[model samples]
Target: MIWWAVLGAGLGCYLLKLAGLSVPPAVLAHPVVSRVADLVPVALLAALVTVQVLAAPEGGALALDARVAALAFAVGLLWLRAPFLVVVFGSAAFAALLRLL
Candidate 1:
């Protein structure tokens, strides 16, 4: 039963990709469409980060933990134009320090 669901999801994803490919180049080239395409990944990544930070590991309840503080630290670094490695490592260290306390 799980395998059937997995296969169905795989097929659905393939169909969705095919549908995206079927869109006309003209539509894809429109200013609004192009801007949306560029921003979609950013929006998706923000949503992913939000879910990871706020969602509890074992249940549906929202969590407030060291991860939130670490995320804020990372955002501050980004606002300061810190390099990518600094942002990643700084956030990890901040989170580790918070957890260790």
Candidate 2:
């Protein structure tokens, strides 16, 4: 069941990526489409961040925890224009300290 779910997700992602590449340059250059396209990455990143930071396992519940703090720190670093590697390492370090405490 898990394998099937993974395969389905991979296939869906591939299809979406292919869809982006398949669009003709002229179509992408259209003012409306271009504006929407520019927003796609930001929207996708927001969605991804939301899922990682907000979702919980089993039944739905809300809690303030170290993982959440780490996520917030990472987002702050991103807002400050920190390099990708620094954000990743800093988040990992923060999470580790939290876990140790």
Candidate 3:
């Protein structure tokens, strides 16, 4: 069952990648499609981050943690227009220190 799950996941990923390559540039460049496509990655990343930072092991409810703190700091830095790398490393360091404490 686990192997089947893994295989299915792999195939799904491959199909998505294949679709990415197979989709014509013209179709992607259409105004409406382009806007949606541009937002898709950000939306997906937001969902992924939300899950990683908020989801609990037993699936009861979201809880705060050092990682969430780091994410908040990172968002603040971005709001302040800090450089990208600075925001990333600053958040990572903050999370590490928080974890240590």
Best TM-score among the predictions, by candidate number = 1
Q: What lDDT is obtained when candidate 2 is compared to the true structure?
A: 0.88
Candidate 2 segments exceeding 4 Å error: 1-25
Which digits, one per residue and each the tens of the lDDT, describe model 3 over residues 1-101? 99999999999999999988999888988999989988999999999998988877678888788988999999999999999999999999999999999
**Per-residue CA lDDT of candidate 2, range 1-101, in tens?**
99999999999999999998998899978999989978999999988977767667654876557779999899899999999999999998998899899
TM-score winner between 2 and 3, please give it. 3
* TM-score against native, each model: 0.95, 0.68, 0.77
Runs in model 1 deviating more than 4 A are: none
lDDT of 1 by residue, 1-101 (tens): 99999999999999999999999999998999999999999999999999999999897899999999999999999999999999999999999999999
Cα lDDT of all candidates, in order?
0.98, 0.88, 0.93
Clash counts for all predictions = 0, 0, 0
State the weakest 10-residue window (summed lDDT) of model 2: 55-64
Better of 1 and 3 by TM-score: 1
What residue runs in model 3 are displaced by over 4 Å at the alpha carbon?
Answer: 20-26
Cα RMSD (Å) between model 3 and the true structure?
Answer: 2.2
Clashes of 2: 0
